[model samples]
Target: MEKTVSAHHACVRTAFENTVPAAPPTSDDIWQTPPPAPAAGMLDVCGRERRLVTRTRERHTAVRQLPDSGSTLENVCRTLQLDRSTVRRFARATSIDELLVKATNRSTILGRYKPHLHQRWNEGCHTSAQLHQEIVALGFTGSLQTVRRYLRPFKAATVAPPARRPAPRPRRIVRWIMTDPGNLTADDAADLKEVRTSCPELDAVTHHVRDFAAMMLDLRGDQLPAWMERVLADDLPSLHSLINGLSRDIDAVTAGLSTPWSSGQVEGQVTRTKLLKRQGFGRANLDFLRKRVLLTP
Candidate 1:
């Protein structure tokens, strides 16, 4: 049975990520409407980002062509076999580039060691081995080859760009939103607060998630209807998918949430049985597999 309380955090995260601007926006240019593409060859957008842009463009065009009488979020989700968040994102984006910024400009893990790499590079420490070892000692954990690859782009340059706020991945942002506020570090809390302030949609979703978390933690399945109603009142297409699924089997979902009974033990037993069966397949017979499954801890 589906849990009484579930969230479409991944869907919401993807939708939110599409809204991140490539460059820092001024107060007057929130997200820049259509952020200009980076200068060609200045930054390499990996193949995946290009493919994502193409796919999003297709969805965006499809949603735009939907007839007026059949263009509700639910209808779009059903017709396209996509989640609500995806439909909403595609329908609302001004351009495909809006969905491409994060993939192109997101912070890389090697970013932290840039200043060190640059200072050492300029000081004539051209030896990859020495440079790799030096940065490793300074808390760099990347492979030596990564250092070699990045150096190619800065081979002739005597400088690197100034550091900027590291863009946490969509999944990381979702985790920050889903986790209990009390469990987050001060830095994480502060960053999440800033993110919420910048994007009111995310802020609204966070509120819904916190409320859902509390209902689940307290085993308060009785409150699900109220929670769902509140969520529906907002433009939260991401969560609507979860609500739709739960509404189909509300009793079972409610019982699953309000009680501790679950299929966990049964699934564990099945998994162990498979492991024992595999272990005995070539080395022994069915009897051995059965004995192991039955007697082994």
Candidate 2:
């Protein structure tokens, strides 16, 4: 009986040892193993570097095609709008292919933190500003622009489809409605038609706007009174207010519309003066600004 009990205890000990997990490697052990090199696809050239490479190759090809003259390098540089050093570098190269090989892409400031960015993106942190702040805490010294560019593709992939009945923005809708019907595309026209169906008042307003635009374009001031009456009769509070304001200066408005003589040139000068004032604000005094404006052709 004693031998049987010892055998059972030995079996239980063996089973428990096998079931228990081994201790994970310590930080010291992890530090001993060097990380594997990143794949080629993991690194990318920025837009400026890519452009530089492309320009170099193009210049090299152009240089090769030109005749071997003393002024050839100068002419190539002038034609390509490249610097003398850039042209000489390409000229010294053995071949166009050599120029390509010489174009090396420098690593970006955020290159080291790309893996962390991917991990955070996959875990659903999509806000670039938030990611920028988080990475800053993790010793990343790159600008928010760099982080934003890196996360563009990931953000695009994770974007939810727009809502079925997205509310129209007032300014955009007004711009669309105010644009000439001829200028609007078929899609825009169809969209406007849909919106009109949703709100009959908008449709009424659109017709009135078109009519008023036509009268102004044709200089038919005779039709202004009738148009104003029609607008006042409508329930469009905004148009009614506009008509009331116009009524205050109806004679001037009528004369300006009917006659070709206008303050357009004077208004243009006024706009220019205002722009000059803003440009020189706090930089130059009003007297200096006046002299500059008066002296300007």
Candidate 3:
């Protein structure tokens, strides 16, 4: 019975196999081809418009290309109907910090001149003429005035240029010691008072300087005219001696003071000097430091 059942199953399978036929290869089977066009109405996943990309050759054929060098300032101005100066200015703006760096660099050239000037001056070669000659040799065609100004500090050193190693510059030491104002406090006023009490002449000088300071400080707005009158009326001789003939420049001083401005600028500068001194950092010489602070800004 088992053999008869197996024979029957085999006969049925053979009959089913003979009814189905093998399929021929389609065109896609031979070519492995892509579709001719996208499927109808397919939307991009990102919801943005789908842009078709092209090969380099296709892109070149689609648009006109301009020559790279054709965008010069003159050409750009003509193309955009704009002024050439406007474009030039925009292109040439190098930044304030860049300008500052360049100026500082140029100023540092004078630093080189410092050592040479000192060396020459030490050997009794110190003269405006000699220094100017050396500067001229070094390509400084500016003027004798420039040379004079540059060499002035060396000549003013408290000690002559040393024949041995450079003197531990007292001026530089003073500057380094004095750059900060930490000690110039109420204590300074007390000390100054004590010194004034000990020396009669010193006391007189101190009082004069203080009065001058008070006069300058008091000159503000409507109070300025009254203040100036008081100062100018007091001991004209003493005023002359304190500020030289600058006391006679009364009108200019009054004008400067009357309009909310005073030698606050000058006093502020002196304060900066004392601060710099306390900080123990200035040029190697006090005179040099003085000139630097005055001339730098």
Best candidate (score: TM-score): 1
**Candidate 2 structure, TM-score to reference:** 0.42
Q: Count backbone clashes in candidate 2.
A: 0
Q: Per-residue CA lDDT of candidate 3, range 186-247, in tens?
A: 53344334434443433443444454555556664344455445545554344335344545
lDDT of 2 by residue, 1-297 (tens): 111112122222223223322232234433574321121111132313356566666677777666365557778778778798877876766545334433422234564455556666767788899988876775667899988886775544654221112222333346667899999977567656755655566666778889988998899998999999988887776677788889999999888778778788999999998888888866989789989799977
Q: Rank the candidates by TM-score, best first.
A: 1, 2, 3
lDDT of 1 by residue, 184-215 (tens): 98867876776676657678788988988888
What lDDT does candidate 1 reach at residue 51? Answer: 52
* Ranking 2 against 3 by lDDT, winner: 2
What does candidate 3 score on TM?
Answer: 0.22
Tell me which of candidates 1 and 3 scores higher on TM-score.
1
lDDT, candidate 2, residue 90? Answer: 65
Clashing pairs in 1: none
lDDT of each: 0.63, 0.60, 0.41
- Model 3 residue 46 CA deviation in Å: 99
Which 10-residue window in model 2 sums to the lowest lDDT?
36-45
